[model samples]
Target: MRLTRYLLALFLGLGLCAGPGLADTPGVGLKPDLRLLVDISGSMKTSDPDNLREPAIELIVRLLPEGSKAGIWVFGEDVRELVPHGVVDSAWRERAREAVPQIDNSGQRTNIPAAITAATYDLERLDPGYRTSIVLLTDGKVDVAESPMVNASSARRLLSATAPNLGATGIAVHTIALSNEADWPFLRALARSTSGIAEKAESPQALSSIFVQALEMVAPTARVPLSDSGFAIDDSVSEFTLLVFFGGARNRLELVDPDGARYSANSSDVDWYQNQQFALVTVASPSAGNWRVKAPDSASLRVNVISDLKLDVDPLPNSLPAGRQTELGLRLTEQGQVLTDAEVLAAFDLSVVITGPGGKQLSIPVSREYALPADGEYRIVIPPFDAPGRYQVVAQLQAQSLQRELPMYVEVVAPPEQPTLVTRGQEPPEDDFQAPLLWLGGVLALLLLAIWLHLRRRKRRKLEIWEKRARQLASNDSEPLEGVSADQ
Candidate 1:
């Protein structure tokens, strides 16, 4: 019955149908439809004391591409939509950034089910060309009530019914669990069942990095590598955004362009947002040459760009059956055309680094020799994945003047084991088989009946203990807790 309730809720909330013209390809060039669900329950006051979630979310909002769709929701005893769902344009991004400050840890309970329902409500109405994903950040269990059993039952319904339905409809639910007390098992299961990534943050400071990783999973961006706080802006790069991380002092970040002209937040062509922890800056039509950031030696920077030159990896399936080998295709393209110059391809070293379920690393080199067709695409055969868990694959390309990395996540699932059959040289006589089967059936019936009675008695004893405790509290003029049904 609980599963039925979950299904009904999901049906009404999500529309329970694949959108018309949904992309048949799993992980190609589809645009992203991202929903961010943040938990603002009381426990977050400890887990994220400084409220770094605000800046972390702002980082995501600023980095989103112009055409994608996104929305933000904060959850506690109930769910509230902080940002309305719409196409990601300049105005939408500004509104989302403004809404980030409203997230706070002041709620009485963590109602994850309600949050999911609200975040995904009417998601089927979106354009079928986009890939739907939900990034759920939480710091506690499903605490809709005082009883742990009730919370556990709610979790079960969510995993058993809702998660599968979401996966079936091509929606990924990426989960982030904060603090040691967070419900890791439930969060991990929810992500695994929906073909999403599961991440844990031991400290609030880690939320920003984890948010960046989650963004990579949902909507990866083309990045221009930053080395020693310096990077080159090629002619193909139309726009570039710099994410600089720093600590200690509150100082303005400055950039030195190709002509050695220094620029800061006050510069004409730069858009900058700064907080205590980090600063995000976007520069349009940057000059083509070497550029450097003026920051402390200990500071770090990441440059993401919108460019004509890009590293393209073949789309990876959301999941793969265990012990199956697959081929991965990689290529370099400039302005939508594959690069076929031998000298250009020979300048870079390309490799694939795979992290398996047990944290083992496997590095496979992508041969410089192009395939028979002479196309720029490089192909590598991924070895059979023997373990049943999530695998992270990163394709890295490094050359004298450029660096690029593409990260992809895939889940490997083991098929159910078949029962082994034992056979004898001779079959038993029909009469003997009939008699033994009847006797065995009687014994099994008796065993099942005994098990039922023992369970009933044990449940009754537990109920009596709870009832006694409740009555004692009531006698002391304390608030009485709600009763839990045995069926739960």
Candidate 2:
């Protein structure tokens, strides 16, 4: 029985070691990992006439945010890594672009199975701290060999199985069909299985645009503000969240949206992480107004919320377009709703602060206010952002003791690049999706080690018991029968 328990414990230890656990705690400050897989089969020669593939690749390589990691793969009968996975920088960008033209169309067939497998392998090699994805751009179907593993059905099945496993590891597979001839159904199904999008592009222009969009989606940017009392949510803002970190003692929090809707910390929408002293609230379709937050005064940590506030001074051509006038827009709301008409807005005083890319600061003239189609929406005009870079705009509103400020960050690229339209404002932190997996892995490893040691000690104790029993029997046999003593 003792031996049976020892064996059982040993098997349990092995079982634990076999399980690769998941991390539950979120990880912070990790960059995204994107791997691009482009089909280089002969069909591409007809489908991609303008040769926009290389240009799209180059553009994506150029625009990827710094610190993010990306790799490029060209797939034919076999897969080739045009650019090895590495952190994005000026040097890396140059190397990635240089390799784009090197992609040749010598292979006659497309082996999507091999390509996907290779990309998955590369992504798996990433430091599990990243939000990883594979952006697959293909213009044709899976035309590889007809084998159990290489046939179309087999390929789909392999991907079908791999997709969920990748998702389990926090990796997604986004598919972009560059032409109508591509296997849209299969691609879409593959992407859906992995919790990714399948985008279709029929023309070179559309494909180029999709490439930029894909890269942007793969590598998102984020900003956190340090403030107290209230933070701004843009008029154009949609859904947003507030993460409040408390310390020392529990803190009470209250949230007021633009439409005057009030929510408390114990509201149904609020999620609390008691162990971490963090509470998060997600607001859907947030009103375009300054959301007020009342946090505990004793909460010493910085408490800033990323809310929806759209206040911008944008040049028609965000590239500034030389002498064009810049359009300034602001949306006002009270409590948590949009304010329309002078009756609802009679109690408010509003002003805007404009800071140019050149560090120049000015205030928009109150007389310059013009009405828009929506209630509480206001617009004005400003001089073009002649010099290139980022500009900061802030709009302020005060109603009695309640004060709100909305901050908008705009980018003005140099001439030649088309104007960039930013529909989304500041992004939330890109927390690690793999953190839970990592934490689980660590705990499982430790548990397995402990179980192994315990089982080994139990086995040693069992062996010691058997040895003692054998010695006792041997001594009795040497002492002769009970009736016959040492004299006999």
Highest TM-score: give the candidate number: 1
Q: Write the per-residue lDDT of candidate 1 for residues 315-395, one digit (tens) a residue.
A: 466567788899888776654456554545565688888999799999987744434225566778889899988888888
Tens digits of per-residue lDDT, candidate 2, 1-488, equal 32223323543554522322111222432457888999888888888876767766765665576677788888888898889888889889878867888876666778887887887775546686566778998888787775645566766675767777876776767788988899898887777667566778867555655665465455532222335666555433345556554444566777887678788756676433222243446575656556787776754322222333222222122123344566655444322234343433444556667788678997874423543323454566666667756566556655443344555444454456669899998665567556877899999999999999999999999999999999998778454457866666
Candidate 1: the clashing residue pairs are: none
RMSD of each: 23.6, 31.7
Candidate 1, superposed: residue stretches over 4 Å from native:
1-28, 123-126, 247-253, 265-268, 314-324, 327-380, 385-392, 396-403, 409-488
* lDDT of candidate 2 at residue 280, scale 0 to 100: 49
What's the TM-score of each model vs. the native?
0.70, 0.42
Candidate 2 TM-score to native: 0.42
Best by lDDT: 1
